[model samples]
Target: MSGQGWERRHAAEYGTTAWSRAVVSCGALVAHHAGYDRRPGAVSEAAAGFRQEWMPVAELLALAACRAGQAQDRPVDDVELPVLLGWADGAHTHLLHTGPLDGHLGPAHWLRLAEDETCRSRARDVVTTESTLAIVESRELTGGRTSTPARALRLGARAAAAQARGVGFPAWADDCAWAADQVERLHLAMQAGAWRPTSAHRAYAREVHRTLVAEPDHPPCPAGAVGPSWIQRVVRIPHVRATVLALAAQPAYAVAAPASDPLGAAVDAVVHVGMEPVSVLAAGLERAWAAQLPDRPVAEWELAHIPGPVREQIRAVEALALRLTVVLLDLWHPHE
Candidate 1:
């Protein structure tokens, strides 16, 4: 499918209401894959297979991420496959897409794709052997980390919790939150030297299975309605601010966001606009669009409906929206 098609498909499946959750899940996946595991064999056979075929499938995800205006614009690469899969896993928890290949695709499939003999051989030759320094240098420059199984579990749990909360079914939310808390405890235990890394993995897997078994059979929402109350509570403007503050407290976001970059400025501008009276805010939003995106219009940004320049501006607007969301959350609920 075309990029725009993929965006609409994803939005239709996931809903714009939960965009923040999707972005957070994606970021967490990147962190888990990069920080926790580096060995090629660590990836499951299915995941490896998906990775091998990622060149084609990834276009959909890339388009979706771009349209959503995620934090970074990292293109798909060997290092990114695992991360993207992680994000998809998280997204699945809340907005499960039941398409032609529903049961057939899962983490294992993607893992196998990555580790397929042909793909692995190609990766070794292209990345590990031909341009080893380039790969290493790129990782260094990007500050990428090796994937850790424990971190993956933790991230999975967190993503699940986020989705569950957004879906607003109390039973699912509680279950997901409990699962995440369990993973977090394991993480803490590992940090305190109370458990071995392998042990933590086993524990996490057990907890995940238990949570799945415990989950309510009923859906979180009506076929086409917003999720439970808790989820809505967590996603509202104030709640979003709280979540952002919590995220900022993490070492990653604190370190990654530059103080005075274009991203920061864009965020500031958005927050400033949002803070105005609702009427004023609406007018100012239009004015800002006219001033910054005059030559290129918003209509053009649509996948099929808009012009190329307008589409480009739409992409920029999405980016600005992400920055603004981050900034507003940070300012309204500043973390230590």
Candidate 2:
């Protein structure tokens, strides 16, 4: 591969331990053929993820093995191959387009695996050459990012729970948009005057029911658009703050929201909007985009989203997604 090509390929392969294992497997096979098992640091070095500098050597050795008939190189169509391919395609789609906040936990799991020297050494033994000493010992298989498996698992579980709640950005944005609409409707209901008397309360309840019937039950705005683009539109809406504050503010909320639970469904809906992960993502993107503007100074997370190298871009997107969740959650429910 050309220097640029190798760089791009490495960028794609780096930080994903599965690919590292594949490369190491190639290295191991080459070691078996060349008697590198007898060498002192062979196994440990290969296990450490085979340095970038060693990649060309590994590739050349692998090719030579295949040419010499020592390593059989052929494509086999397994029954499960199609199913696996479909899943991989779907996962990529979900990650980049449909559900960016979900299922990028592979790196974390790999990092854990990298730490287990015993298991790795045992696996190497299982695939060892005739003489038995292995030629692959490597560390930091999943790049330099320090992701705890337990923490990654928690985040993955949360993201999965959020998935059960709804699909990507559109689904979440629709809820918020609908909630804002509810707030507007409630504001309109209270606009005439305060309903102090029992009869006035009844009349107010009737009005709420009528409005509820007139408006669609489901979210109206989101038409399946995903990610920051759709949410940017939502953040740009002029009346969002005013509408949210209509229900969130003290006196207005107290007087406007009905006493009975059914009559106060609008308030409930707004609260539900706050609970969804997608809403949090939207809020985070709002803040990030704001920082991107010339007047607003860019923060570290904000700068990550800027166009750059493939590896940098991938890291940036992941960081932004993670940071967004944190920031939005804090803003949604800031604690003392």
Candidate 3:
């Protein structure tokens, strides 16, 4: 709980290990904006259990958090298991790999500077140059079409890294036109049925759907899934409905209705991060897809359109996402 040590350790390991690598990898994947790492096993077992009928969405989220944060350490403490930090750290990729620092990096590609303390200064130069190289490669891949926020973040992160390395900061461009462009695109997409999740998001939703259908009648946890130190949490239908209403009540998002894609809420969450939060929309869309695993058509999925019980079971994912951002920047964020 001592943030002092946590900060030192996080800075010590930031982008210097498997966890940081995963962050950059995920970030690059997301910064590309439209594609996912759809190769088989792209969704690791670590990312699995998203819709396990027995596990609460909260726990499934916690487990994945444990895995991502655990990259700094891979397992969550008993008391701190619920919050996830992958979102914030994952965003580091935008800073590390976009613009002039881009690269075809992923979790598997391991790159580290010399570890000798005597070589610390030289090591930093290596990191800044490497970060720059990654940016260069990413720009090459994107054909010089990097967005505004993406460019700013990559430069900012690299400069931060250079500062950490005891080097001078590099000057960067001030063109940030892309954030507005993205927000506009989102609105246009919504008009064209973009708020809804595509078919790809269905698999995760199906699991949550089954869990809702079987709950209240059957036991909370299925056979063998239950264990000590576990508390059963059956989400209440009315409470969930109220929370959704509250979100819609004072939202900065355009889609306030339940049937509206969680994309709107996700973009709202990004505004809080102060960077290009729209990138997080990809993850939100996947979650929204899960929440909408209704037994009927989405057009009829207005809050009232959903069954009370299932609606309770299928909750908004932005709450978890925003919470994860906090966990990343606050709890697990090494900067403390």
TM-score of each: 0.19, 0.25, 0.19
Query: How many steric overlaps are in each model, in order?
Result: 37, 12, 11
The sequence of per-residue lDDT tens digits that candidate 3 reaches over residues 274-318 is: 222222222322233344444633322221122222122222222
lDDT of each: 0.31, 0.31, 0.29
* RMSD value for candidate 3: 22.7
Model 3 alpha-carbon drift over 4 Å, by segment: 1-247, 250-256, 260-276, 279-336
Q: Arrange candidates by lDDT, highest first: which order?
A: 2, 1, 3
- Specify the highest-TM-score model's number: 2
Q: Candidate 2, residues 1-336: lDDT per residue as tens digits?
A: 333343344334333222232334344333333334323323565544434333333333222222221111111100111122222222221221221111233434433433444433332332232112111100122242433222111111122222222222222344455555654554444444341224433443343333322312121223443323322333322123234444334443344353443225444444444333334344434543453434432222222222112122223223332332333233223355
lDDT of 2 at 72: 18
Over 292-323, each residue of candidate 1 has an lDDT whose tens digit, in order, gives 33343222211111212222222333343344
Model 2: runs farther than 4 Å from truth? 1-112, 115-229, 236-242, 246-253, 258-261, 274-278, 291-336
Q: What is the lDDT of residue 191 in candidate 1?
A: 48
Task: Give, for candidate 1, the lowest lDDT window spanning 10 residues.
Answer: 299-308
